[model samples]
Target: MSNVISAKNLTLAYDNGRKEIIKNASFNIKKGDFVFITGPSGSGKSTLLKSLYGQLKPKEGNLVVGGRDLANIGSRQLQELRTHMGIIFQDYKLINEWTVAKNVVLPLMIAGYSLDVQETQAHRLLKHVKLSEHADKYPLELSGGEQQRVGVARALAKNPVVILADEPTGNLDDYSSNVIWDLMENACQQLETTVLVVTHKIPTIFSLPYRHFIIESKGVYEVH
Candidate 1:
């Protein structure tokens, strides 16, 4: 399989290079691969994720995603690249004013889909996430897990090639976390989506094969 994400000698720093978080890390994630990146607090797991989505530029080395180089990508080019990616955050970033269904269809709206098509896709995704009953409810009205479920639905709405999740299950209970895992696994298996998740713990419920990497002392290593 071809690589969907590639990094070579990637060095990430902050405060104008005064402090470096990830140094000389190299890895390649192929299409349809399910990857888990784990580390302790302040270990730069989230920082590395940010680089993947173009939120943080590399201080050194080459980084590529979906066949586009992020080293010196312009604003317009970066925006175009992001449309093919789905990002899920630990802190569910849903619009409070929009209803659940509307939040889920935000991507479709951005892509200029008609109202009918957007509503149809949203309904299907809401059902998949088991949140169809909460379609009209506001995000704040739901529990943390429910809100995160909506976030997952929104991320999958666009049928993105790669899903980048940062500590996706950090604040969830086992049941909810497993629910999220199942949805992501289905996306990988059925939809052929590449998934890269950064978490403190990789749940034991995963039945499919996956790749695990750990960040420590400013280096990334594959776990067997």
Candidate 2:
């Protein structure tokens, strides 16, 4: 499979270039692969992810995602590139007013799926995440784990080609975190989605295959 995300000689910084995060970084994530970006806090793992989703532009070098160059895309074009990606944040970016099912189906609705199809897929995804019983509950009414599962359901609603997760299980218990990992692995295997997760700590033992990439000394290093 070809590269779904490619970064070459990439650099990301903040504060008007006063702070440099990733400098001269290069990496490639192929289609249908499960990968992890691990580093200490403030090492720019999140910034690198932002570049992939076009949330942050590279300060230098080339960053291409889904075959589109992100370093210089217009606003509308960046939005178009994002349509091919699903993002999961640590805080579970969900509307408190919306029920779990509604939250899960938002992507489908935005994609203009019929109400009937949205209902069907939303329910199916909820069931997959073991949140069927909580589908009618609002995001605030559920625990953090449940809300994260809802986020997972929402991310999968669009059948995104690439899924970007930022500390998705950061605040969850072992059970919940393991469940989330299982769900992600299953999605990669079943839907062939390229999954990239940014976290500070990855379990020492894991069954699913994944590449381990670390950021340190102002660069990205893929562990062999």
Candidate 3:
């Protein structure tokens, strides 16, 4: 399989102080693969995901996403690279003022997709998230689980090449967590979208196939 993300001896750090968070880290995530990252609170899992999305710049070694090397890209090139990625936050970051449908269509709108296509795709995604009936409501009108479902719908809006999720189930109940996992599984199994989720731990039981990475000693390793 072709790799979508490849890292070797990468160093990630904070911009202000150049304080390293992840050092000499190396890994590869293949296209259409489903992967999970887990570690303690300050383990730099989020930092790694930020690097995938170009939000963090590596200070050393090679870090490549899709076909672009992060160390070689300018702002324009970095933005272009990010066009193929989608992100789901731990908190549902939907705009409270916009209707659920409108919020879900934000990415498509940004990409200049036609209104007709936006509506059709948004409805389809909403249906998949089981929120078609709540499309007309605002984010604040939904429960935590429903709001997260809207977040899922929004993340898949552009048919992104990969989806990066950060603690997507951290705040949800078991029922909602299962719903979110099922949606993610379907995205990988049926839609063939690559997925990388950062969480505190991996579950003991899962029916779908996925790789597990863990951060320790300031490096990342494939644990399963």
- Report the number of the highest-TM-score candidate: 1
Off by over 4 Å in 1: none
After superposing candidate 3, which stretches have Cα over 4 Å from the reference?
15-17
Could you give candidate 2's per-residue lDDT for residues 41-149 as a string of tens digits?
Answer: 8888888888788878889999989988888889998877787788898999998988889999988887788999999998899999999999888899998998999
Candidate 2: how many backbone clashes? Answer: 0
lDDT of 1 by residue, 49-118 (tens): 9999999999999999988889899999999889888899999999999999999999889889999999
State the C-alpha lDDT per candidate.
Answer: 0.95, 0.90, 0.89
Give me candidate 2's TM-score against the actual structure: 0.97
Report per-prediction Cα RMSD to one decimal.
0.7, 1.1, 1.3
Taking the tens digit of each residue's C-alpha lDDT, what string does model 3 give over 126-168? Answer: 9989999999999999999999999998988888889999999
RMSD of 1: 0.7
Clash numbers, per candidate:
0, 0, 0
List clashing residue pairs in candidate 1: none
TM-score (all chains, Cα) for each model:
0.98, 0.97, 0.96
